[model samples]
Target: MSASDNKIVNQENKNSADIITWREYEALRNEMRREFRTNDDELKSTVDEIKQTLDATNVTVTGLSDQMTDIQRNIADMRLAIENLTVLQQQQQEDDDDPELEDDAHNARGAPRGHRPRGWVPLGRNGRGQDEEDGLGKPKFSIPKFEGGADVEEYLTWELKIEKLWSLHPHYSEDRKIKLASSEFDGYALRWWDSLVRNLDEDGAQPIRTWRAMKEAMTSRFVPTNYMRNIFDKLTLLRQGVKTVDEYYMEMEMLMQRGRVRESLEMTMQRFLNGLKYDVKGIVRHYTYTNMNQLLHHAREAESQLAEEAKVKGRATGAGRFTPRSFYSAGAFDALHSLLYSA
Candidate 1:
């Protein structure tokens, strides 16, 4: 009886122990699963935060790129504007012939009334810078009287002076310009203008309303018909003569400008060559010259060389006159031999 009871009790005890072990193992597995779920949720939240940060960063980068592009475009527009302004300034300089009218007499806005600075003169109703209050100041300059004449040079000089004066006072109206120039006319020129005006009124034609029209009328009447032909004839017969190369070149250039003659570089060079003295031209023709300046430079060298040779010959002849006669010289011996043979 005791052995069996003890065996049964032991079996029951073992079964209880096995049940307890299984319960503990099940509780541990459930705890581990809950911990894994918590960790997985935290990882998902972290990943979402990282994705949001990347999206914000991308938007910021795109905005910065657009701003950079706009800045570049603005810079290009500014550069183009500078280039155009520079071109305009250069053209203005060329047209004005570097006149002293570049300084501003007053501000961009009109000057206050009754402010007259030193060396500043008021514009005139009849002519430039006459004593009158036009509310503007210009540097004082004189316009010469044209007074019609047979001297074409006089007319040309007067016209040039008028044009330069007008360039200084570009704000002048066309009618003002015509009247200002007409006021300076005297002698035959005044009579011509008066006669032209009367003829215009009689024909009911508009009088010379612009400076350009006035110039055309005056030039046609004052410039002789054969004046241009005379210039051409002189050019055709022009030669260096006693003048130096520089003098000849300047005269030729002046004549060409007066005639408004345009020629190819080769043709101009040939004309210049043909006008040179024979000795200089012979040396210059043998050399290769591409431009007129080069030709002129070579011609001058040739002239100088010829001049030096002539000076040396003069010096040698003078020295020989001072020295005693040398009968042993080849030329003297030949002469002496000829004389003896003829005798």
Candidate 2:
């Protein structure tokens, strides 16, 4: 009876222990599931934070890309600007090289192809038709164009025409034309020409007011200067030598200017005709020339023909001067030589 009771009690105790262990195991399993759930939630939060960081980094990268694109555009614009500036500099350099665009103050570097130089443009502002300051800082005046002349009135007239072309301002008066007309000529007269000049008044002490007055004064004192003495002298002396017709005519024109004489075209033509040598004058004397230009043209033509005739004569002399008697003489000698050989 005691052993059965003890065995049953032990079994009941064992069953109770098993029930307690089962309940503890169930609680541990619930706690482990809660811890796992908490860890998974923390991991999910870390993943979300990483995703947010990646999104922010992507946004920054997009902004940087936009900035880089802007930088590239700015660089391209600068390159374009530099290229345009280079083109402008090249254009300016080309303009500077152009003859027409060269500084007008330089005038011409040298005379035109075949023509003799007109006048040397003095260095600096002197040749720009500008008023120059003298040593004492005073305004120095000079004739714009006075090569050299004996006739004061004609010379002044020519200078006035040049002044008009330059549109130069005059020192004397506000009006350029009136100032030129009233310019003093006595000061500019050369020694060779002025030596013969005599004053107008009885005492000859007073200065003339203008060039016109000076000219009138001279006219009274030196009307043609010994009558036709100088005129006839020049006409007789004038002759065209090796100089071209233009050069010859220029010399005659200068003579005319010196004498203060203006002849009609016909009178000039006759003067030129009378001055020529025998052969040349004879050819020109027959034509009733209306203009000196026409006479010069015909005279040049005759001169050319005479030159050709002389050249033909020279050629004929050169070809036949020391030649043998005939080509037939050489042939006769050859025939005699053959006959001798045959004998």
Candidate 3:
């Protein structure tokens, strides 16, 4: 129990307390570091997950945008198709509503009850013909007959007769007496029973059969020469000659309108000027005239002046050029005037 022993004990006790505090502080620091590490790892995992989710979201958004664009395009295409179909339907309906250009028989017959004329066929119902089964009526018109394979005139006449016969009657049975149109044949329909022969060439009227084909052949054969002949005749015969300026212009103008000249307006005007009686043409051309109206106006003025000058010259001398009042021309008057004046 001395003072020194007490001091030593106190020192040991302080040392033990310091050692305990150091241990506790070290443990707390270690635990805090572990917790910080755990928090950092958790934060890193969360960040990584968020990054993956963002990448996936970007991909999904891009796909959706592309899909939306494609959907928009498809919608646009559908709208256009619908609009076109609507317009086409409307036009078809309009055309359906419009009356057909035909004989009044279409209206006089009245509206159809069903898809077709109701009941038995009219020609059968009346029992008018020799056979009710056949649609043939009394033959009001006769076929003028044809041997076929002829010139344009003969062929044309024969074709017209066939047309007339078909137009007059609704049907004709194929016999020696009469023949009908057929699709199985080269031409039209066969109203009667089957042919005994399979490949019998139904000569419905050969060399020219179908109306279109016949017309085409006829036009090619006959029209070209006739067209040329007309042009030649017009050119040879049509002349201004002694006609007045207005008369000549009007004649040429009429011919021009009728497409007789088949040339440009300038060329036509040139032809008309060439054909004119020289005196009117010369003075009119001397003036500035770009078109027909101006040309006609100037020509009339010049013609009047020529007539007046001719009248003056005729009074002074005995002879002259062309004039309405007298048979005097400016050219002859000029010569006579020069002869007398020179003397």
Candidate 4:
């Protein structure tokens, strides 16, 4: 009873210890597996969030890039518009010479006979009086006339009078007047005469033969053609080299200073005109500005009027408010301003 009973009790104690150890191990393993599952789910969620952020960032970058491209395109277009306007202005300047030819042609006809010539001469024979015949008889060209009472009759009487005056004037030698008229009108005689009505209206002159006389008087007052040609050459050179408005302004300012002329605010404006001319000749083919031409014309008028006023006043009057030179400067300022401020 003593030895056998003690051995059995020891064995039972060992068996109980082994069973408890096995249960503890199983519980620890289950806890570890649950923790790993939680960590894995957290990692997947973090990765998905990062991917979403990356996609959003890409979309934003792409949109910004597209907007930048559009802005660049607009800038190019504006540049082109400015360039085309310049070329048009140059063409107009060249055409200014044509009007002189018309004056010479009018003078060459000599005195109008007190009566119409024999052939195709309507001596009030077309059932109209002399005045009415004069109105209807000359080759009727449908042309624009002044808004006032300057119709066909008025124009015909004026033309006849001018011819008579040309014949009588001390300076008008028959041959010289003919040559001068021919040289002045050249290819543009009829067209120049047609344009005279508008010119007269603008200048506040009455539509009469005296209009031609006034023009001839003015032409005589100008410096020779060669002097103007030299001015044109220099202007053209300066216009072509300037890339930016600022550069152009500086050059013009220098010119004014050298000429001993007070720097006009209109100089700034002239720079703008030059910029437009440059843009027209250089950039217009590549880019388009719808109103560039009109802007250029306005600038030109402002410059011309300012210059005239300066001449009349005996000094620079508008210099403080708008420097005549300012016209030239405005072109560059506008270009840069557009580039910076535009959306």
Native RMSD of candidate 1 (Å): 21.0
Model 4 residue runs over 4 Å out of place are 1-20, 96-343
lDDT score for residue 138 of model 4: 24
- Candidate 2 colliding pairs, count: 0
TM-scores of the candidates in the order shown: 0.50, 0.36, 0.29, 0.25
Model 1 CA deviation exceeding 4 Å by range: 1-139, 163-177, 206-212, 262-266, 286-291, 321-343
**Local accuracy by lDDT, each model:** 0.77, 0.59, 0.56, 0.49
Q: What lDDT tens digits, residue by residue, belong to model 3 across residues 56-129?
A: 99999999999999999899779768865664454344333434312222543565654333332232233221
**In candidate 2, what are the lDDT values of residues 1-343, reduced to their tens digit?**
6999999999999998776577889999999999999999999999999999999999999999999999998997797688656644543454345443244324455556554444332333433222211111112354444334455455546554645543643322222322333343344444323443333344545435344554455455434455446665875689887766567778787667656567777778777776665676677666666777788887877777777999999999888764445655668767877899999
- Using lDDT as the measure, name the better of candidate 1 and candidate 4: 1
Question: How many angstroms is residue 206 displaced in model 3 relative to the true structure, after the best TM-score fit?
Answer: 19
**Predicted structure with the largest TM-score when compared to the true one:** 1
Candidate 2 lands at a TM-score of 0.36
Ranking by lDDT: 1, 2, 3, 4
lDDT of 2: 0.59
- Candidate 4, residue 43: how far the Cα is off, in Å: 1.4
Models ranked on TM-score: 1, 2, 3, 4
Output the lDDT of residue 127, model 2: 34
lDDT of 1 at 134: 31
